[model samples]
Target: MTNALTFFEPTRTAGLERLRNFAPDAGRHYGERRNYLGTAKNPGAVSALSPYLRTGLVSQSEVLRTVLDQHSAKDADRYIAEVLWRSYWQGWLALRPSVWDAYQADLKRLHNAVQTQSGLRQRWENACLGQTGIAPFDAWANELAHSGYLHNHARMWFASIWVHTLELPWQLGADFFLRHLLDGCPASNTLGWKWVAGIQTIGKPYLATQENIEKFTEGRFAKVPGLATQAAPIPAPPHPDRMPLWNTGQPDPALHSGLILHEDNLNPTHVLDAAGPIAGHVTVMATADQTPWQMAPHVQAFRGQAAQNMQNLLADRIGPAGPAVTSALALKQWAQDHGFAQLVTADAPVGPTKALFDAYDRLPDAPPLVRMRAPLDADAWPLATAGFFKFRKHIPALLARLS
Candidate 1:
């Protein structure tokens, strides 16, 4: 019943193969067709490396460098911006972490409203089930549910419809995407929905017109009826001011250390090289913690298998790494088993995995978890203090640093 298996191969080799195959078209060809909504089986202009990039099977530096090798930055401008957008979102969330905290609180408050209000509950259920009778929106809802993905344009249209046309709570829509999307991250999914509703950029909500949908979809659902023509901004407090980024934690080589490998960064060659020899390693997965509802089975299976792939691929360097655990308590127990002095790991951005570690750091018996951040992130995240346009101005400099 799952197309996720065939759609994405869940291996580094597969990702590299995709990148090389798509590099030839990384120029003007990409910009021309990037917004076209083709079937999931045919990734029109997109690279389809998102699932890989999401799990760090392929790094941004690798992808960007490969594309730049094939074409100049001016030629691949749109494609380059698309790649950097992921980092921009990650950095934006990292700097203003309170945004994540506020989102968590909204979900809690909204869940109670969903439970108590029957009329609202029915509308939300119908929307999730794709039974709202809006052709394009329903198709997108079904597509996301069945495929664990949607074209970037489709996501924007779907969110705009969900918030404006359907008049549903944007938090629920974001949660639905998070539960299903294989490549979903807190920064992109949450803030993206907010932007559509005008919370992220105040009073500038994105609207999904029927004509625009028909155009991007190549006339799939012509004359689609009842899409929202105008979108009003959702009221919200301004986002928190920017905070200082954390310096990369240096894993003390002399101490008895074990690497805590997680879903955040599976192929952390930089971390392993920097962390020195490890006593052992244990794995942790926070996928199930993304929502109170059951996660899509494919989402769970993909990451579980991806972790297995990493363990096998880097077996020599990641010595004794396996036996994945799900919670912070289990991590504490693993530390007890080895009585390690320190735990080295990839620095998690603002997500469920980070939330788990936030809990771990508070544990009375918890050992120090040295979060090794990539130099790329350390260098780029600081520049994300302002809006994306300001961040965009530094693209040339960022690309230069990659070399």
Candidate 2:
């Protein structure tokens, strides 16, 4: 059978249309059925717009606007909160960038352990290969690898099993998802796994019971055995105090500029609208920088193709666009070769793309890198200084600001 992931087209037009089609259901219908874990052939109630949203093919504001046009905030509150959760995670990590650094360090150590330790390697390999022997867990593993997506409920259950039942390292589990999930975002994926492991919220690990799985899957995974009963929180250091969000300076019209597009923010129309005309454009593929290990072939292909789709979408605005380039040296050379006085692009949140940009900024004699953050992020991220509950309290005001 063809891979179920092919159903998701990686383009702005496809993303926008998906959002439009899902908007009418964004309210009560979504609230009622969002948790059902239907198969890839039938994804039940939830909107599978995450890949688009994660890669910036479509902006959260645009999604919120579309949904709200069809339903009131009260009517669509659940869906709206779900969308804002992404921003909250991004902002939360942006403030405590050390969390991301720590995750990377931990991933490297664990990756090395998997290579050097035979028993551990066997267990990790079994889990990744979907030979775990637990039916639901094994099915989810295969589903994620085969489809590049999973239901939200399934994700929580899968993470719980990985950390508690399978007795595997949570970082390894998170890495496994990042390698496969089409919408695998740095902040959401890492922090989400951390949350399930009880590290993000501290002492509130998500426990998946057999009965809960049966309920959500509508008896499909009933009577599942070998699930852990207790979910004690993983030990972790106290969260660092929130740092100020980065101040992305306004783009200067007078300077000769080039637009740099990347996987994090594929669509640059808003950037172009704000920054005015540019001298040239360049596409940067930083998906390889997501991990030290080789990313899944599908993940790489999807991002590369999505970037190309963006280039096609913005063909009119992009002058003398160059081929897709990777690495800081290549980006610097491209900027200099095009005679660009400065480089402006969409603000990349805390992830591989941001790391790539940070490296480029530090390079000696590199042109100025001006990041243009979306107005939605500029307003929403600062409110994420606390938990989702507190951050969510401001959703109404944030939505108002978008109007």
**TM-score of candidate 2 to 2 decimals:** 0.97
Measured against the true structure, the TM-scores of the candidates, in listed sequence, are 0.97, 0.97
Worst 10 residues of 2 by lDDT: 1-10
Quote the positional error of residue 70 for candidate 1 in Å: 0.6
Scored against the true structure, residue 40 in model 2 reaches a CA lDDT of 55
Write down the lDDT of every candidate, Cα atoms only: 0.86, 0.87
RMSD of each: 1.3, 1.4
Q: Write the per-residue lDDT of candidate 2 for residues 1-403, one digit (tens) a residue.
A: 2263486678888889888888899999999999989655577898899889988898898999999999999999999999999999998999998888888998889978988999999999999999989999999999988888899999999999999998899999989999888899999999999999988888889999988999999899888887888875577789988888776877888889999998888886678987868878888888677676878877777777788888877888877788688898899999888878889999999988888888998899998999988888888888888899999989989999999
Off by over 4 Å in 2: 1-5
Output the number of the lDDT-best candidate. 2
